[model samples]
Target: LFAIAFALLRKYPTNEEEDFDRLIDNWSRREQPLFIERALPAVTPNNDEPPPDYHSEENLLVFNQAIADYLVTSGYTVSCKEFCREANISINDSADKKDQLEKKWTSVIRLQKKVMDLELKLQEALQEATVGGPTREKRSPGEWIPRPPEKFELRGHRDTVTHVVFHPTFDVIASASEDATIKIWDYESGEHERTLKGHTAPVQDIAFDHTGKWLLSCSADMSIRLWDFQTYQCIKTMHGHDHNVSSVTFTPSGDHIISSSRDKTIKIWEVSTTFCIKTLTGHREWVRMVRVYQDGTLIASASVDHTIRIWSLPSGECKSELRGHENVVECIAWANDSAGPYISEPIANGGTEVCSFLVLQVVCW
Candidate 1:
């Protein structure tokens, strides 16, 4: 429920952003040689509004394995039809039962077989291609470069990693996974500092307000939760999103929150008052992303239907629609910020340039 004691970094001017970026970029992505690593047992779930029980996932896996072993030991090899018939299971054509269906089953055994066969064949193919075909530098068109990921990892989420976020002002990373908990990690130090468990459903989405003082989460359980990031406690549950709440965001002023849901509506709530200030209903499909401008004057919405729309804030007037992206516009970023004096100045060899220095000098004593 508490962050381990550490020094907080001071915010520097935009001109010094390069320095900060360099510091973080040069920060070793490699981990130190620490002694033993251990998986701490997570806290028991609270049933009050519990997310599904992922705690018993291991037990379920073990049971399945035991069942498979028993079947194998009894000299009953799984013929798809026999397996389903003996099990007295019926799967609709849409959701087929692996063993009974004509389609290749994506089972544990089948998956392992696929991996072994693919790897074996790929090795031979690579050898043949290398011996008789063109070299890497002399390859023909359509050759894969085999470049590795910029940043990829096997994140150890027992179930699903529902949400991932970087800290507003720190190198810290937070993720809420279907393990029915939230976890904070120091990606720089490769240290998992804390795991937060409270929500009972898969946390759909999460956001930090402008100041990063508070965190908000919406879950499939049709509830919006307010969490005090410092204390790591759920302080409030704003239960208005009737269906699965898909996304939640705090306004720039941190006084209000805008949330979108499978309920096909977006609700703006006054956080301090915990009251629904306005409900925006227009999208035919699920509204995926809702963002408020820094001035709190505009709200931008992106949906599954591939169009983006902007709405006037607080008043809930539909303002304008932005058309371009040809897919589900799940994300939007207002990256353009007015440059202050400290950010940068342009160089001019032949023509005049707007001087931020002059503007600052005129405004200052």
Candidate 2:
């Protein structure tokens, strides 16, 4: 009878093995006679009467009571009907109770999935907000977007303007034109302040000194002119190019100026002496534009030969030659010292379309 009760305890799953063992021990002490009469008939050999019914109402009552006592001792406050259902026992109202339990479990699982989905959506919304949200300008399919309107126009040039430059330290601007003049203007008010006239031919390019006190202009008349910007007077005229002077720029130190010409040469001149200090000659065609490094250590020139040459300043030695443009390289501009430099050239087959290339590094020879 004890072995049969132990086997019955091992067959059922409970929260803890020790709790079940304690339950069996309590049952043995409280219902020893009931267990012996109900569970030992199968193993008794000489009994002539039929074995007691295992499913009798009296046996069922004893089983339910035993489970109720175990739950109370284990600190569980479940009702008798709940404990019977947990043990898989069939009672009068068990089917309805089982249906209700199944519905409740299904609802809980569905609600948990919905909560996870909502959490995911909320995370995505927060990420979008942190990343500055969607773009403000949305274009429709096949719509033609127009370019932004110009802020203001300066209209003092009587002919096609060759170049325009802003003073480094002031609100003044200077513009060169084919009308044989350079016009200085108050850029903030769009008022033409003065017209500088010295070149017999069209002025090609203009530049301002580092101190913004002087200006330089090169012209097709084969001469470079330095002007006092404050007094609007030509201070010095430099004549060295055999052909048209195309471009000119002052060095960052304001002690020298560099000029390029259709004669295929670049001349570095002393600002005070007005004498050519060095001449860089390597381009096979006309040099179009020239720019100096901020530290006055390097100079770069663009040419009609479809190449750009980097030269060491004051040494006149070519450091490197950059060649990839299909047409004449026309302009070069440098960003801040940390941002590198770029050059622009017109494409050979594309009308009026220009392509810019970045100058990554210059290796000295």
Candidate 3:
């Protein structure tokens, strides 16, 4: 039994008493002589000496001490009961106390292993952050950077300005205001150049065409008007929405204009004839804003319905709906870069928040 137990301990090399119990239970029912013959060489203490009678208490004590020494040198701690069990020796002790010590030592070994793993991970992180690695910028004590001063402000709008856009090819700015007008300004001189006045109600949005030749304006009067920006003359008026027209923008080619309305619809217009070519109708609440993708193949609209929907341009079919906003979705924009497309929502009371997603993926923020 001692020879078999020592052979099992040497083969498995574990500190747990369960391993010794399992091996004894498995081998004790087998033929004794054959087991002794197979286990004698494995449990032998030395090459030059004949095998000792391992069943003797003295021999068992010598073998157990050798195993205990090996375990200690290899950085393992085993209890007296476990060490004795590995040599098939019985011990008299309170079962509860033995179990408590075994559990405590097991927990200590587990915690030590966790600490070693954490130390290794911390060392790797420190190595990556040192020597000009791609880490966050570090600021020195008492050092600071100042913000640049504002250049100029264009101040002519009598009411809250809802939208402002820079001209595509000129040093001009177009701003729509609740004052029922779209104001043109010379940005370099910060001068209010002219105010285009035709809308009977507040002008909600204004967008310059791709060539900066025309400006599209939508208003609370339920109308979208195109203007010859250079002459400051109203070119044409397109009307189809039953409620306030909230926002408008020209498609990338400048051949069509897209407008969103409080009537929960998006209308596509032909720029040449001032005709409503198609109307998209999936939003359940007021459509707040609309924008065309750079390629003119897709259109995105946000609504008080708390969702943003992407629609195919010509077919006007709803492609995807993104939902997560707890309040109204106020605005949407394309980054036109590798960082991908994003939408912005204004909190009911004030601040602006932004959400980004991969183009056409339809994920919530």
Candidate 4:
């Protein structure tokens, strides 16, 4: 047995990493031309006018054949369910096999609208390039306008996904769902990696510690659970709140946790001991979310009472309350350092009028 195993290992020395790199290099080399041929067929010079029924069954046959050929050439395989999932097409599970046919009539109408939008943008860019002038827009100093295109949608949660947090250092995201599970996903490819389950009730929020070594989640079960990120196992379940725990966050130092609950209170827990050290109560109604300041000196919380409160750490004393919101404030975050100067300044008129311009721009959009 030892001789046979050694012989096989020597004969089949793995080249998986080299093969994968070669495959990626080939894909990148073909990407531009292939995209032009398939994605922009309607605008190609040879095919100046696309078929009126571009998504008709006959046309779909051509598209499917092209995809199948590409898959074969690329050494890839996909099941029907996986293909349908990526295309966002629903499958009729109850339909008879003979009666079930590829449904494209409805999807065609929706896809045509999207294709038209892309075609317009492509035409504009093409014309701009021909003119030999700048194809980008100019903006004033400190002005930023971002309109990023959707790449892919992450699906699989059975219930509402309450919160999503990016891993501090990894290309992954943790999502808390009302399905009572925390799901880890590949942020780049939108792939569901694994599900972490322990909560008996819906999970309300999730956060990763600074080192990305652990994750903390609060749920409607009136408890908080800590999980080892590396092992994907629940390390400790901390229970203290009388009612549903709405939100949780790690202190800047990642040494402690702050949680807000429907019990109208916020509690600070010592992570090392997994014990509730202090519970601050002041919210007139259920607290929706709580966040720690960058310096870890202050904690900010929002509540169903339509007010925001700032609390001092260690002492657990409410320093100030901001009111005037007409509806529940479901989330809160401390502004980044760049916004400090503007937030602290009194409103005034100026040539640029940063504050008013921002307000008007938001309103117009």
Candidate 5:
């Protein structure tokens, strides 16, 4: 009986202008219930006599009334008794049975409403995916081109900005200036953040350690000061250079520092002990800049003597001198992390020093 009622609910005609008598006759023939007492023995527990055939007028009225009750609850304009009269069926069932059927139909309608809501959500999800499309992997490479356009400028320094280095893991930049200060700025927004003011003279260079916990700066006052990145305080100061300290950088391991000066010497200092470990001397003029190889095995120094010298770490030995530039070599850097071969390659012009430098790659600006 419930299955026939469900079928009537699903296939009920919607057009009010259609023939109601024809719709009733079609549903009566197509959705006739089975033998209720025999098929559902539990429903007729009190009845000892067998019920009439499912097609009999009495049982048919029960089925028709169930349909009329469901349709009326679902917003049909006609009444249950009126629908029964139009279909020529008598309403002999008790009011209690009608209430029970009404409760069951209410539950079915609630479940049907929930099903419709879920289907609408599924369709919305599919449409969103189709419109947004797939996403790129996290490690995918971005666009690469030479001489890219500048995005923005950081313009807070009062004097000439000598050197700038990006924080290893933060969206900030540290810049040294001739105004005797090191300024920090938000790299993404180009906003001034803070300044370190311990240096007494012009600040020549600044570098952040590998962990970005400390900042090192060299000054014309012949001092190299280490500042805590978080507290912005000068934690340690080293004063061994006889002339102006020109450049400073931390080794890859962050345990030592390499600095060059107008004193024409490169000094390596132990970070923990605050002591000068080794000093490399070869340049006849002021050393302009110094950069350590990525592997921490070698150091490159540019000098006003028109030469670039490669020094071996820990041993304080000048390995080779690169020459041929007629003017002072103001700056020097390893072309790539694997630039050892290019620096060590013997020139074909019978010169002991590397005369020609080959650029393997450009890692950053």
Candidate 6:
């Protein structure tokens, strides 16, 4: 009975012994999940590291040696390490890699040049499309189209064809006659398009502004008429040019007009309004012809005094004189853009410079 009691008491162990048993229980509980169902099977590592990635080691060696030899020939005294760094290739001292890079770079440059050339050709083609004709369908081969004559007669004009000019953006021509009528002709077909009639007196001059949307006529009836090219409506009749308005021209901007009269005064008239803006005063005789320069800086007028006077367009002040026409100056033309001479500034010592010296950076033609 005593032995049984002692054994039962021992089953309830000492504190130190109980603590060690609890620790062992906890450790085994944590390790149980690590094995899941069971521990994994062992595998040995691969024996010879992977097979080498080398291809043609002999050829590669030959190329590397050739590069070293060529570099020496080319006077490059670079070490192999330095060459590798400079070449930016993956392999050190590899001539094949260098050759590959050279070929790739050359291909890239060739492709870039081809792109640039194609872009230039595209721009030229677009330019030809706009300037050559209205539409692709309107293209008439050179053999079919008639060339414009340097001088052509307007048979419809009973008197002398006092003025003739092309339409600004179309295949049409306009002429003013001393017989008091203005006629429009098809420039390509050589056919009469329309006849504008309103002035009782002889039509002395005709002009089309930069847009070709309006036609302006000055007449011996002492009036200037503005005609819409589309509707042929008399948009406005200017009554300011004293006596007979002999000659007229639209400014390059189409904002204002200039007219010369036998009344001895030249008037600048504003478009869209019948008001006269300025009356140039200088001529001692009747003004015969007036022209507006392309630059819009000067107004040239001819008179019976047989001299052409150039006045500043903005202030109406006389700028220069071209004095040699013995008769009434009939006509004048500026040099083409190709022939436009540059006005050079005087040198420090009073010598003249070549026209190209004062040239603007951008070439117009």
Best by lDDT: 3
Comparing 1 and 5 by TM-score, which wins? 5
Per-candidate TM equals 0.50, 0.56, 0.57, 0.55, 0.55, 0.51
Candidates ranked by lDDT, best first?
Answer: 3, 2, 5, 4, 6, 1
Tens digit of lDDT per residue, candidate 3, span 1-365?
Answer: 34444464556555454655554455455454553454345554687887667468775555455445433433444544466565564443222233343353356446556666886999867654553244235744322332234347778889999989999888888899999988888888988888889999999999888899999999999999999977889989998999999989999899999999999999999999999989999999999999887778888898999888888898998878877778887787775545455655564446566655455464432
**Which is superior by lDDT, 2 or 6?**
2
Give me the runs in candidate 6 sitting further than 4 Å from their true place. 1-154, 337-365
CA-lDDT, candidates in order: 0.61, 0.74, 0.74, 0.70, 0.74, 0.66
User: Least lDDT summed over 10 consecutive residues: which range in candidate 1?
Assistant: 1-10
Worst 10 residues of 4 by lDDT: 344-353
Candidate 3, residue 147: how far the Cα is off, in Å:
4.3
Among these predictions, the greatest TM-score belongs to: 3
- Scored against the true structure, residue 321 in model 5 reaches a CA lDDT of 73
Clashes in model 4: which pairs?
none
Give the alpha carbon lDDT tens digit for every residue of 254-307 in model 5. 999999999999999999987998888899999988888888887888888877
Window of ten residues with lowest summed lDDT in model 3? 92-101
Collision count for each candidate, in order: 3, 0, 0, 0, 0, 0
Task: TM-score for candidate 5, please give it.
Answer: 0.55
Residue 3 of candidate 3: its Cα lDDT? 49
User: What tens digits encode model 6's per-residue C-alpha lDDT throughout 134-182?
Assistant: 4435565552343344334547778878888889899999999888999
TM-score winner between 5 and 6, please give it.
Answer: 5
User: Which residue pairs does candidate 6 place in steric collision?
Assistant: none
Model 3 CA deviation exceeding 4 Å by range = 1-148, 340-365
**After superposition, which runs of candidate 5 have C-alpha atoms over 4 Å from their true positions?**
1-150, 339-365
